[model samples]
Target: MKIALIAHDEKKKDMIQFTTAYSPILKSHQLYATGTTGALISKKTGLPVHKVKSGPLGGDQQIGAKVANNEIDIVIFFKDPLTAQPHEPDISALMRLCDVYLIPLATNMATAEVMVKGLEHGDLSWREIVKEQEGNDI
Candidate 1:
Protein backbone atom coordinates (compact mmCIF):
# COMPACT_ATOMS: atom_id res chain seq x y z
CA MET A 1 0.00 0.00 0.00
CA LYS A 2 1.10 3.55 -0.68
CA ILE A 3 0.48 5.89 2.22
CA ALA A 4 0.77 9.67 2.17
CA LEU A 5 1.45 11.56 5.38
CA ILE A 6 1.15 15.25 6.15
CA ALA A 7 1.17 17.32 9.28
CA HIS A 8 0.66 20.95 9.93
CA ASP A 9 3.54 22.81 11.55
CA GLU A 10 2.03 22.65 15.03
CA LYS A 11 1.22 18.95 14.75
CA LYS A 12 4.52 17.76 13.36
CA LYS A 13 5.74 16.50 16.71
CA ASP A 14 2.65 14.40 17.24
CA MET A 15 2.94 13.06 13.73
CA ILE A 16 6.51 12.05 14.38
CA GLN A 17 5.58 10.22 17.56
CA PHE A 18 2.66 8.50 15.91
CA THR A 19 4.76 7.33 13.00
CA THR A 20 7.46 6.16 15.36
CA ALA A 21 4.96 4.02 17.24
CA TYR A 22 3.61 2.55 14.03
CA SER A 23 6.89 2.36 12.11
CA PRO A 24 6.96 -1.39 12.11
CA ILE A 25 3.58 -1.66 10.41
CA LEU A 26 4.38 1.30 8.19
CA LYS A 27 7.74 -0.07 7.13
CA SER A 28 6.12 -2.68 4.93
CA HIS A 29 4.62 -0.09 2.63
CA GLN A 30 5.73 2.83 0.51
CA LEU A 31 5.49 6.22 2.15
CA TYR A 32 5.16 9.73 0.77
CA ALA A 33 5.10 12.98 2.69
CA THR A 34 5.52 16.70 2.39
CA GLY A 35 9.01 18.16 2.80
CA THR A 36 9.56 19.08 6.43
CA THR A 37 7.32 16.40 7.82
CA GLY A 38 9.02 13.77 5.74
CA ALA A 39 12.44 14.89 6.90
CA LEU A 40 11.31 14.89 10.50
CA ILE A 41 9.79 11.43 10.28
CA SER A 42 12.86 10.08 8.56
CA LYS A 43 15.00 11.49 11.34
CA LYS A 44 12.82 10.03 14.05
CA THR A 45 11.80 6.68 12.52
CA GLY A 46 14.37 6.06 9.77
CA LEU A 47 11.54 5.32 7.34
CA PRO A 48 12.20 6.03 3.72
CA VAL A 49 9.68 8.50 2.36
CA HIS A 50 9.36 10.27 -0.93
CA LYS A 51 9.38 13.91 -0.07
CA VAL A 52 7.61 16.58 -2.04
CA LYS A 53 7.63 20.37 -1.68
CA SER A 54 6.27 21.94 1.45
CA GLY A 55 2.48 21.97 1.56
CA PRO A 56 2.10 25.70 1.21
CA LEU A 57 4.41 25.37 -1.74
CA GLY A 58 2.12 22.83 -3.44
CA GLY A 59 2.93 19.54 -1.75
CA ASP A 60 -0.65 18.92 -0.78
CA GLN A 61 -1.66 19.25 -4.41
CA GLN A 62 1.04 16.77 -5.34
CA ILE A 63 -0.44 14.22 -2.96
CA GLY A 64 -3.89 15.12 -4.17
CA ALA A 65 -2.81 14.26 -7.69
CA LYS A 66 -1.61 10.87 -6.55
CA VAL A 67 -4.91 10.26 -4.81
CA ALA A 68 -6.81 11.30 -7.92
CA ASN A 69 -4.78 8.84 -9.96
CA ASN A 70 -5.40 6.07 -7.44
CA GLU A 71 -1.70 5.88 -6.67
CA ILE A 72 -2.27 6.35 -2.96
CA ASP A 73 -4.42 4.09 -0.80
CA ILE A 74 -4.45 5.99 2.45
CA VAL A 75 -3.71 9.43 3.86
CA ILE A 76 -2.84 10.54 7.38
CA PHE A 77 -3.01 14.29 7.60
CA PHE A 78 -2.56 15.65 11.09
CA LYS A 79 -4.10 19.04 10.83
CA ASP A 80 -4.46 21.55 13.63
CA PRO A 81 -8.00 22.75 13.24
CA LEU A 82 -7.77 25.34 15.96
CA THR A 83 -5.15 27.26 14.06
CA ALA A 84 -5.69 28.95 10.73
CA GLN A 85 -3.59 27.94 7.76
CA PRO A 86 -2.40 30.17 5.01
CA HIS A 87 -3.02 27.39 2.51
CA GLU A 88 -6.38 26.26 3.75
CA PRO A 89 -7.82 25.99 0.26
CA ASP A 90 -5.18 23.50 -0.80
CA ILE A 91 -5.81 21.46 2.31
CA SER A 92 -9.52 21.46 1.67
CA ALA A 93 -8.99 20.40 -1.92
CA LEU A 94 -6.74 17.58 -0.83
CA MET A 95 -9.43 16.26 1.51
CA ARG A 96 -11.98 16.54 -1.26
CA LEU A 97 -9.74 14.60 -3.58
CA CYS A 98 -9.38 11.87 -1.02
CA ASP A 99 -13.16 11.62 -0.83
CA VAL A 100 -13.44 11.63 -4.60
CA TYR A 101 -10.90 8.85 -4.86
CA LEU A 102 -12.58 6.78 -2.19
CA ILE A 103 -9.41 6.67 -0.13
CA PRO A 104 -9.29 6.48 3.65
CA LEU A 105 -8.07 9.65 5.36
CA ALA A 106 -7.20 10.35 8.99
CA THR A 107 -7.13 14.01 9.91
CA ASN A 108 -6.37 13.60 13.57
CA MET A 109 -4.19 11.44 15.80
CA ALA A 110 -7.05 9.32 17.18
CA THR A 111 -8.31 8.41 13.75
CA ALA A 112 -4.77 7.86 12.55
CA GLU A 113 -4.20 5.40 15.36
CA VAL A 114 -7.27 3.43 14.34
CA MET A 115 -6.17 3.28 10.73
CA VAL A 116 -2.63 2.32 11.64
CA LYS A 117 -3.93 -0.40 13.92
CA GLY A 118 -6.10 -1.65 11.10
CA LEU A 119 -3.03 -1.78 8.90
CA GLU A 120 -1.09 -3.60 11.59
CA HIS A 121 -3.80 -6.21 11.58
CA GLY A 122 -4.98 -7.65 8.29
CA ASP A 123 -7.81 -5.22 7.74
CA LEU A 124 -5.99 -3.36 5.00
CA SER A 125 -5.30 -6.37 2.85
CA TRP A 126 -7.65 -5.00 0.24
CA ARG A 127 -4.98 -2.43 -0.56
CA GLU A 128 -2.64 -5.16 -1.69
CA ILE A 129 -5.00 -6.14 -4.49
CA VAL A 130 -5.25 -2.54 -5.60
CA LYS A 131 -1.50 -2.21 -5.58
CA GLU A 132 -1.01 -5.41 -7.52
CA GLN A 133 -3.45 -4.33 -10.18
CA GLU A 134 -1.74 -0.99 -10.41
CA GLY A 135 1.59 -2.66 -11.04
CA ASN A 136 0.33 -4.84 -13.84
CA ASP A 137 0.59 -3.88 -17.45
CA ILE A 138 -2.45 -4.30 -19.67
Candidate 2:
Protein backbone atom coordinates (compact mmCIF):
# COMPACT_ATOMS: atom_id res chain seq x y z
CA MET A 1 0.00 0.00 0.00
CA LYS A 2 1.04 3.60 -0.61
CA ILE A 3 0.37 6.00 2.24
CA ALA A 4 0.71 9.76 2.35
CA LEU A 5 1.34 11.55 5.62
CA ILE A 6 0.58 15.24 6.10
CA ALA A 7 0.14 17.51 9.08
CA HIS A 8 -0.43 21.12 9.96
CA ASP A 9 2.37 22.91 11.76
CA GLU A 10 0.58 22.58 15.08
CA LYS A 11 0.12 18.86 14.70
CA LYS A 12 3.55 17.90 13.45
CA LYS A 13 4.54 16.54 16.83
CA ASP A 14 1.50 14.33 16.97
CA MET A 15 2.22 13.14 13.47
CA ILE A 16 5.74 12.26 14.51
CA GLN A 17 4.46 10.30 17.46
CA PHE A 18 1.95 8.44 15.35
CA THR A 19 4.56 7.51 12.76
CA THR A 20 7.00 6.37 15.40
CA ALA A 21 4.40 4.13 17.04
CA TYR A 22 3.44 2.58 13.74
CA SER A 23 6.91 2.39 12.24
CA PRO A 24 7.01 -1.40 12.22
CA ILE A 25 3.81 -1.76 10.25
CA LEU A 26 4.53 1.32 8.14
CA LYS A 27 8.03 0.39 7.11
CA SER A 28 6.73 -2.29 4.82
CA HIS A 29 4.78 0.17 2.71
CA GLN A 30 5.72 3.12 0.53
CA LEU A 31 5.49 6.37 2.51
CA TYR A 32 5.05 9.86 1.12
CA ALA A 33 4.80 13.15 2.98
CA THR A 34 5.04 16.88 2.71
CA GLY A 35 8.51 18.43 3.10
CA THR A 36 9.16 19.08 6.77
CA THR A 37 6.96 16.26 7.95
CA GLY A 38 8.69 13.79 5.65
CA ALA A 39 12.13 14.89 6.78
CA LEU A 40 11.18 14.66 10.43
CA ILE A 41 9.58 11.25 10.02
CA SER A 42 12.59 9.89 8.17
CA LYS A 43 15.02 11.33 10.68
CA LYS A 44 13.09 10.17 13.73
CA THR A 45 11.78 6.79 12.62
CA GLY A 46 14.43 5.91 10.09
CA LEU A 47 11.63 4.93 7.71
CA PRO A 48 12.01 5.69 4.03
CA VAL A 49 9.66 8.49 2.94
CA HIS A 50 9.30 10.18 -0.41
CA LYS A 51 9.28 13.89 0.23
CA VAL A 52 7.38 16.50 -1.69
CA LYS A 53 7.25 20.28 -1.32
CA SER A 54 5.89 21.82 1.84
CA GLY A 55 2.09 21.72 1.92
CA PRO A 56 1.73 25.48 1.60
CA LEU A 57 4.22 25.25 -1.20
CA GLY A 58 2.06 22.85 -3.22
CA GLY A 59 2.77 19.49 -1.59
CA ASP A 60 -0.89 18.93 -0.86
CA GLN A 61 -1.72 19.38 -4.52
CA GLN A 62 1.10 17.01 -5.50
CA ILE A 63 -0.35 14.31 -3.29
CA GLY A 64 -3.82 15.05 -4.59
CA ALA A 65 -2.53 14.50 -8.09
CA LYS A 66 -1.28 11.07 -7.09
CA VAL A 67 -4.62 10.33 -5.46
CA ALA A 68 -6.37 11.22 -8.69
CA ASN A 69 -3.98 8.95 -10.56
CA ASN A 70 -4.91 6.09 -8.20
CA GLU A 71 -1.35 5.85 -6.98
CA ILE A 72 -2.01 6.47 -3.30
CA ASP A 73 -4.22 4.23 -1.21
CA ILE A 74 -4.33 5.99 2.14
CA VAL A 75 -3.91 9.53 3.42
CA ILE A 76 -3.29 10.56 7.00
CA PHE A 77 -3.59 14.29 7.46
CA PHE A 78 -3.41 15.85 10.90
CA LYS A 79 -5.36 19.06 10.61
CA ASP A 80 -5.46 21.88 13.11
CA PRO A 81 -9.10 22.73 13.02
CA LEU A 82 -8.83 25.63 15.38
CA THR A 83 -6.25 27.50 13.39
CA ALA A 84 -6.64 29.17 10.03
CA GLN A 85 -4.58 27.91 7.14
CA PRO A 86 -3.36 30.07 4.32
CA HIS A 87 -3.65 27.18 1.92
CA GLU A 88 -7.10 26.06 2.91
CA PRO A 89 -8.20 25.72 -0.70
CA ASP A 90 -5.42 23.30 -1.46
CA ILE A 91 -6.24 21.25 1.59
CA SER A 92 -9.90 21.14 0.64
CA ALA A 93 -9.00 20.02 -2.85
CA LEU A 94 -6.88 17.22 -1.49
CA MET A 95 -9.71 15.96 0.72
CA ARG A 96 -12.11 16.16 -2.16
CA LEU A 97 -9.78 14.12 -4.35
CA CYS A 98 -9.61 11.45 -1.72
CA ASP A 99 -13.38 11.25 -1.86
CA VAL A 100 -13.45 11.29 -5.62
CA TYR A 101 -10.91 8.46 -5.76
CA LEU A 102 -12.50 6.52 -2.91
CA ILE A 103 -9.18 6.56 -1.12
CA PRO A 104 -9.23 6.21 2.67
CA LEU A 105 -8.44 9.38 4.56
CA ALA A 106 -7.94 10.05 8.26
CA THR A 107 -7.96 13.66 9.38
CA ASN A 108 -7.31 13.12 13.04
CA MET A 109 -5.37 10.85 15.35
CA ALA A 110 -8.31 8.67 16.37
CA THR A 111 -9.30 7.81 12.82
CA ALA A 112 -5.67 7.40 11.79
CA GLU A 113 -5.01 4.91 14.56
CA VAL A 114 -7.96 2.82 13.49
CA MET A 115 -7.00 2.99 9.82
CA VAL A 116 -3.40 1.99 10.53
CA LYS A 117 -4.54 -1.02 12.49
CA GLY A 118 -6.97 -1.90 9.73
CA LEU A 119 -4.19 -1.64 7.20
CA GLU A 120 -2.18 -4.12 9.23
CA HIS A 121 -5.10 -6.55 9.28
CA GLY A 122 -5.79 -6.44 5.54
CA ASP A 123 -8.97 -4.44 5.92
CA LEU A 124 -7.86 -2.21 3.08
CA SER A 125 -7.07 -4.94 0.57
CA TRP A 126 -10.07 -3.71 -1.39
CA ARG A 127 -7.84 -0.89 -2.59
CA GLU A 128 -6.00 -3.35 -4.80
CA ILE A 129 -9.24 -4.30 -6.48
CA VAL A 130 -10.01 -0.66 -7.08
CA LYS A 131 -6.61 -0.12 -8.58
CA GLU A 132 -7.05 -3.13 -10.87
CA GLN A 133 -10.39 -1.83 -12.01
CA GLU A 134 -8.88 1.57 -12.67
CA GLY A 135 -6.27 -0.07 -14.85
CA ASN A 136 -8.97 -1.84 -16.82
CA ASP A 137 -10.64 1.49 -17.54
CA ILE A 138 -7.47 2.78 -19.10
Candidate 3:
Protein backbone atom coordinates (compact mmCIF):
# COMPACT_ATOMS: atom_id res chain seq x y z
CA MET A 1 0.00 0.00 0.00
CA LYS A 2 1.07 3.58 -0.61
CA ILE A 3 0.98 5.60 2.61
CA ALA A 4 1.45 9.32 3.07
CA LEU A 5 3.04 10.80 6.20
CA ILE A 6 2.56 14.46 6.88
CA ALA A 7 3.34 16.52 9.94
CA HIS A 8 3.15 20.14 10.89
CA ASP A 9 6.27 21.80 12.25
CA GLU A 10 5.16 21.35 15.81
CA LYS A 11 4.20 17.73 15.29
CA LYS A 12 7.32 16.53 13.54
CA LYS A 13 8.81 15.16 16.73
CA ASP A 14 5.75 13.05 17.44
CA MET A 15 5.71 11.89 13.85
CA ILE A 16 9.36 10.89 14.09
CA GLN A 17 8.76 8.91 17.25
CA PHE A 18 5.73 7.21 15.78
CA THR A 19 7.60 6.31 12.62
CA THR A 20 10.52 5.01 14.62
CA ALA A 21 8.30 2.73 16.66
CA TYR A 22 6.53 1.49 13.54
CA SER A 23 9.49 1.26 11.19
CA PRO A 24 9.29 -2.48 10.81
CA ILE A 25 5.70 -2.36 9.64
CA LEU A 26 6.28 0.76 7.57
CA LYS A 27 9.30 -0.59 5.70
CA SER A 28 7.09 -3.11 3.98
CA HIS A 29 5.03 -0.43 2.27
CA GLN A 30 5.64 2.56 0.04
CA LEU A 31 5.98 5.73 2.09
CA TYR A 32 5.66 9.38 1.14
CA ALA A 33 5.91 12.65 3.03
CA THR A 34 6.22 16.37 2.74
CA GLY A 35 9.82 17.61 2.21
CA THR A 36 11.26 18.34 5.61
CA THR A 37 9.24 15.64 7.28
CA GLY A 38 10.43 13.10 4.75
CA ALA A 39 14.04 14.13 5.22
CA LEU A 40 13.79 13.85 8.94
CA ILE A 41 12.03 10.50 8.88
CA SER A 42 14.50 9.11 6.41
CA LYS A 43 17.36 10.30 8.53
CA LYS A 44 15.99 8.94 11.77
CA THR A 45 14.39 5.68 10.66
CA GLY A 46 16.32 4.94 7.44
CA LEU A 47 13.03 4.30 5.68
CA PRO A 48 12.88 5.43 2.10
CA VAL A 49 10.19 8.05 1.71
CA HIS A 50 9.15 9.82 -1.46
CA LYS A 51 9.43 13.48 -0.66
CA VAL A 52 7.25 16.20 -2.09
CA LYS A 53 7.21 19.96 -1.58
CA SER A 54 6.68 21.51 1.79
CA GLY A 55 2.98 21.77 2.62
CA PRO A 56 2.74 25.53 2.29
CA LEU A 57 4.59 25.17 -0.97
CA GLY A 58 2.05 22.72 -2.44
CA GLY A 59 2.92 19.33 -0.97
CA ASP A 60 -0.62 18.74 0.27
CA GLN A 61 -2.01 19.44 -3.19
CA GLN A 62 0.37 16.96 -4.74
CA ILE A 63 -0.78 14.26 -2.34
CA GLY A 64 -4.38 15.24 -2.97
CA ALA A 65 -3.89 14.56 -6.66
CA LYS A 66 -2.47 11.13 -5.86
CA VAL A 67 -5.49 10.36 -3.71
CA ALA A 68 -7.82 11.44 -6.50
CA ASN A 69 -5.96 9.15 -8.87
CA ASN A 70 -6.20 6.24 -6.44
CA GLU A 71 -2.44 6.13 -6.04
CA ILE A 72 -2.53 6.67 -2.30
CA ASP A 73 -4.26 4.19 0.01
CA ILE A 74 -3.67 5.74 3.41
CA VAL A 75 -2.85 9.14 4.85
CA ILE A 76 -1.35 9.93 8.25
CA PHE A 77 -1.42 13.67 8.67
CA PHE A 78 -0.45 15.18 12.01
CA LYS A 79 -1.75 18.69 11.96
CA ASP A 80 -1.26 21.25 14.72
CA PRO A 81 -4.71 22.63 15.29
CA LEU A 82 -3.49 25.28 17.68
CA THR A 83 -1.44 26.93 14.98
CA ALA A 84 -2.78 28.83 12.03
CA GLN A 85 -1.55 27.69 8.65
CA PRO A 86 -1.28 30.00 5.72
CA HIS A 87 -2.23 27.27 3.28
CA GLU A 88 -5.28 26.11 5.15
CA PRO A 89 -7.28 25.78 1.96
CA ASP A 90 -4.85 23.24 0.56
CA ILE A 91 -5.05 21.21 3.74
CA SER A 92 -8.83 21.26 3.61
CA ALA A 93 -8.80 20.18 0.00
CA LEU A 94 -6.44 17.30 0.74
CA MET A 95 -8.68 16.14 3.60
CA ARG A 96 -11.79 16.42 1.47
CA LEU A 97 -10.20 14.38 -1.25
CA CYS A 98 -9.41 11.65 1.24
CA ASP A 99 -13.10 11.53 2.16
CA VAL A 100 -14.17 11.56 -1.46
CA TYR A 101 -11.81 8.75 -2.33
CA LEU A 102 -12.57 6.61 0.71
CA ILE A 103 -8.91 6.56 1.77
CA PRO A 104 -8.02 5.70 5.36
CA LEU A 105 -6.94 8.90 7.09
CA ALA A 106 -5.45 9.62 10.52
CA THR A 107 -5.24 13.17 11.79
CA ASN A 108 -4.20 12.51 15.36
CA MET A 109 -1.80 10.24 17.25
CA ALA A 110 -4.55 8.06 18.78
CA THR A 111 -6.18 7.39 15.44
CA ALA A 112 -2.77 7.01 13.84
CA GLU A 113 -1.86 4.27 16.28
CA VAL A 114 -5.01 2.39 15.33
CA MET A 115 -4.32 2.78 11.65
CA VAL A 116 -0.73 1.59 12.02
CA LYS A 117 -1.80 -1.47 13.99
CA GLY A 118 -4.54 -2.14 11.49
CA LEU A 119 -1.98 -2.04 8.72
CA GLU A 120 0.25 -4.43 10.59
CA HIS A 121 -2.59 -6.86 11.30
CA GLY A 122 -3.89 -7.02 7.73
CA ASP A 123 -6.94 -5.08 8.82
CA LEU A 124 -6.33 -2.81 5.88
CA SER A 125 -6.29 -5.70 3.44
CA TRP A 126 -9.36 -4.20 1.84
CA ARG A 127 -7.03 -1.81 0.04
CA GLU A 128 -5.53 -4.73 -1.81
CA ILE A 129 -8.96 -6.23 -2.43
CA VAL A 130 -10.16 -3.01 -3.98
CA LYS A 131 -7.08 -2.75 -6.11
CA GLU A 132 -7.47 -6.30 -7.34
CA GLN A 133 -11.08 -5.61 -8.26
CA GLU A 134 -10.09 -2.49 -10.11
CA GLY A 135 -7.49 -4.42 -12.05
CA ASN A 136 -10.08 -7.03 -12.98
CA ASP A 137 -12.50 -4.34 -14.13
CA ILE A 138 -9.93 -3.07 -16.54
**Which candidate leads the pack in TM-score?**
2
Ranking of models by lDDT: 2, 3, 1
Query: What lDDT does each candidate get?
Result: 0.93, 0.97, 0.96
**RMSD after Cα superposition, model 2:** 0.7
Range of the 10 consecutive residues with the lowest summed lDDT in candidate 1: 129-138
On a 0 to 1 TM-score scale, where does candidate 1 land against the true structure?
Answer: 0.92
Per-candidate TM vs. native? 0.92, 0.98, 0.97
Q: Candidate 3 lDDT, tens digit per residue, 4-108?
A: 999999999999999999999999999999999999999999999999999999999999999998999999999999999999999999999999989999998
Query: Candidate 2 regions off by >4 Å?
Result: none
Task: State the local distance difference test value for candidate 3.
Answer: 0.96
For lDDT, candidate 2 versus 3, the one ahead is: 2
What is the Cα-based lDDT of residue 117 in candidate 3?
99
Taking every candidate in turn, the Cα RMSD to the unseen true structure, in Å, is 1.9, 0.7, 0.8
| Pairs with steric clashes in candidate 3 | none
Candidate 2, 3: how far from true, in Å? 0.2
